[model samples]
Target: MIVGGQLVDEPSATSPGTFVSVDNGVPLSATNPAGSGDWTGWSITRSLIDGLPALFARNAATGALY
Candidate 1:
């Protein structure tokens, strides 16, 4: 996930989820629960498959893109 413009590792139940400070929208420390917490820090800024340019052709019988 993303936090304050940087990527962060997944969070656990005990460890607070990725979150940002509402005051300035900065990534708050996992230890700090006073700030916005348990927030999903994901953004679709670009296409992940853009680098892998390819065309998948499915079999005539199969309707799946392969």
Candidate 2:
């Protein structure tokens, strides 16, 4: 579980989860799963500086943008 964009781990198994903010400290997406194995669905995005073009990539698992 995420809270504020940083990974967190606890010992008692009752502590809150961690958060991960994306896009330069911007909140992009969030997820809360019941079980774990291979959390799929993600995407990616490339940005341009001045005149260059940006490229965006998406995957089949998490649908996350990078």
Top lDDT hit = 2
Q: TM-scores across all candidates?
A: 0.21, 0.24
lDDT of 1 by residue, 1-66 (tens): 445534344434444754443443444334212233332332323333768644332323323333
lDDT of 2 by residue, 21-62 (tens): 333243333432323322234333458879797755454555
Residue 32 of model 2 has an lDDT of 26
Error of 1 at 44 (Å): 5.4
Q: In candidate 2, what residue range of length 10 has the lowest lDDT sum?
A: 1-10
RMSD of 2: 12.5
